[model samples]
Target: MCSHTCAPSTLLQRDSISKCSLCLCTWLNPRRWLNLQEYQSKKLMQDSGVAVQRFYVAHTASEALEAAKRLKAKEIVLKAQILAGGRGKGVFDSGLKGGVHLIKDPAVVGELAKKMLGFNLTTKQTPKEGVKVKTVMVAEALDISRETYFAILMDRACNGPVMVGSPQGGMDIEEVAASNPELIFKEVIDIFKGVQDDQALRMAANLGFKGPLQRQAADQIKRLYDLFLKVDATQVEVNPFGETPEGQVVCFDAKINFDDNAEFRQKSVFAMDDMSESDPTEMEAAKWDLKYIGMDGNIACFVNGAGLAMATCDIIDLHGGKPANFLDLGGGVKERQVYEAFKLLTADPKVEAILVNIFGGIVNCAIIANGITKACRELELKVPLVVRLEGTNVHEAKRILTESGLPITAAEDLDDAAKKAVAAIRK
Candidate 1:
């Protein structure tokens, strides 16, 4: 079902796939994964021997000016370091036209940096409020002769890693994939053997590099793959992996995503995460080892499993209600965690009603019931609450809720729960 080419892996059975499959799925769907800023990604690339323009990171106007002067280039490029894409076309809250600018004079770099730093930059990939720019990358500008696309990604279709490249670059690769599919080329890599020399050469050739330039591009591609494996990366993409007018190949811009599963072993890489760019509520949820994503709706949902959590949101929408957040408690949740979950839900001003949908497999329904009662009393919950419990010890949980003398509405099923949650909001 993956969009990329299909290939079987020795590690996986024909009937079963690995988590990397879901990784690839989320990548195609454009979900928010653990990714680094451009400066961080390019730093990894440069350390791994991938040719890139010399750059310096600046946190202040004076630092920006110093960085530009340090680059000592005739023309310097100042890029506001935000996590979002489309930054070149993005506008800052200060009325600045672009997040990226090419400075002809190094002295004026401080002025532009003043307009960028501490300002919120809204791009197509960011929310309307936008993310604040705290840092900038001042780098030497290049005279590029040809631009090309290159990427290494975990592919479900390949059952492992895949190298993707294209002659078309510096634009939305998704549009190219949709329009001119032939321009997109793919090489399924042997995971054990790694990216073969021939595989690298073929990808470089496909990107339209010729003569000595092709060899340089191939070497860069190999180094990128080494970096990918070194960091346990799920995806590494270079847009406009370009050739200079002087016949030098360099990575113009890049984005890298690391596998969340590898955080245990890749601690150093994970530590580089910029939490300021993330939602405050989501970060709070992470402290409790909970999976939560904030949404734009008014109904907050707390479910035991990811699949059921999604279903709860869908059914809420089906009943003319919108979900404010997706909070998955997973299995074996503690009573305190449940209480904390309710605290989070009630804390959201947008949440007019709360929906608790739990299927007790490894979880005990009584723990959830006790947590709910404690949360309502301790937090003095103001929002209407709807509860739908099933699986283990369901009767004991229902009895506890009934004896609590709370204003909680008990539902017979998920459908009833969603309807009640929506009706509670309307009232």
Candidate 2:
């Protein structure tokens, strides 16, 4: 465990960390799992011996008022319990000034909570439509001596976990990363041994922690590493980690995002799943084991492999056409799935033309062609359909298309296929 030394005079004035170079900021994508709300992970941090303030989760205005009244502190921080940040600058759907506020009057908590609850809160990190604030976290306000960033995440380049710390925090980490990357210091952690003494001390030095504070900081780093490993979390972050006037560091704002693949073992994390968090269609695509991302355009893509799907979209754009969506049928897709993909493409009102680009290696071109033929016959395909088939029973696929006598246009290559798709959309 790390320790901090405080002089009587320094603690009196609440002297904070003065240096900025001791800080670093970075954000990690949990990716597979549903992103957890700040309130959700706050307990995890506190339970692991990381510093966290007392807080109450209120689902209703009355509950918020009651919770605020129960707080020992004269002033409390009311934060909208949303997955995305920028709450301080964000506006509520009810036209509230801020998603985060410092309230001294307990009576006002009800009013503020009323405006936030069931209202949409939009932030830069969220979708354009924003997410609804179903609840709020009301916590005691603190006198922060310093605000610094710290985190531990897997580093693909190093093939292991890396601990990052910075003296500069509280601002957008993205800006810090882009404009002043040198300020951030990272140390690689050993998976076999976990966080070593040297790594924690190095991170402590970077944070400019001294005496007991350095030891405490180092100890917290180790515990955080342990937490990440214990929960199989992809990231554990404490942005704007607060150093109290008493010379004690606390996780003022904490985030722990777990890996989705490990959910089978992480039952607690799995229990936090929120299905409404991501795109519904994308979730459906996941069921088919297909790679798909919806976009705004008229031409739809049906291609094998992600690289070719990207190229198909680019060429469509290059030829003055917009791709309606990105659909990549990975190696070994079922014939029924191809038909279903076609159905999905036609389901989009914006899709005026369907472009099929198949480079059959492990894929059977005949199945693809047959699937298209089946979809067209059964669904009575209204839009123009273009097929560009190559390799692995390519002639048989072409012969099947010929026999079907569907108005499906055949292209010789990718570029020619793109041109035809665009032209078909225009016509």
Candidate 3:
């Protein structure tokens, strides 16, 4: 039940050596990864003239029942509006039952919605505790005859855009691609020309489409391509792009992912999903253009660059210290950003100690030093923090920290920093 599908690009490093097998990706900025819900994806596709099943969203059981009654269909599918997959077969920790249900009678919609609403459902794709389903969607049942997988994404191997599709859909396409590699069809698009009509026809023919539907299917691909670039989408997926008995094609499911860096242009699509509803720390990091993801460890490791962050985490684990979080301050660091990162670390009770690993390229160590002093006095962080500074005014940075009269321990290198931070938490 894969929803958002995109292979992150591998990060390249200059003159770095470590035994730790850590994979880093600076291309797909972690802070910018935006995943739209199923209903939301459908709406975006519908706007592009793609046919989709009619549905209505309900935030309460009464609303759900009312929405179903309005549909007046003989059968309906009630889907939980959570940002996770495998909902149809997922189980809730509270034993609330299924995330998706099909009811023959409209009366059953209220009964099922009662059990699903306000319940946190743990799916194979969600967190261990699962996401809460505050709303549910009731859609009219469709007579889908054929299910096919269709997607356009950036191929890391090709280093360009590629459209992938297969007649096999509604199953793990990855597994299918692995077991039956020949079954999958790929069309590498020309950067200047975009996805050509011939390529779309090939994709349609590969998906078993024939007659006038082939032309319709090709037009669908063209429209999807236009939408993809227009919205700055990294990946556009329509799994089980269904073919009806009437020789018409409709998207049974849709998924669209946009690059966070280009979010300024795609504000409308992003505004569809509220930023306030996102994780507080993640949203806060976005405000400062920092990349952050929390973990369940005591040693909070802060560093510059994505590759360095991964390396820091590896070194911390090597030194028997688990990282509390991965926080990367992008190039050209400012004192305010440094203070903000430290302030965030202080707010986390799980953070027993802090490790500041800064590689000042365009980032001046002097500003970092000032930020540390300001953050220390303002937050009054009682926990031990190990600081490691390298490149661009390193000596000046050390002098500022040494004379600041703080209890912070200074490390010579990454290994030294990890050892000191681990020692602080152990005590």
Which candidate achieves the best TM-score against the true structure?
1
What is the C-alpha lDDT profile of model 2 across 44-66, one tens digit per residue? 77777777888999999999999
Residue clash pairs of candidate 1:
none
Which candidate order results from sorting by lDDT in descending order? 1, 3, 2
lDDT winner between candidates 1 and 2: 1
- Tens-digit lDDT track for model 1 on 264-306? 9998887888878887777787777677767789999999876
TM-score of each: 0.90, 0.84, 0.87
Q: Considering TM-score, which of the candidate structures 2 and 3 is the better prediction for this target?
A: 3
Residues 316-416 of candidate 3 have per-residue lDDT tens digits of 99999898886788886888898898878778889999999999998888888889988998889899989999998999999999999999899999999
Residue 137, model 1: Cα distance from true site in angstroms: 0.6
Q: After superposition on all CA atoms, what RMSD does each candidate show versus the true structure?
A: 4.9, 8.5, 4.8
lDDT of 2: 0.79
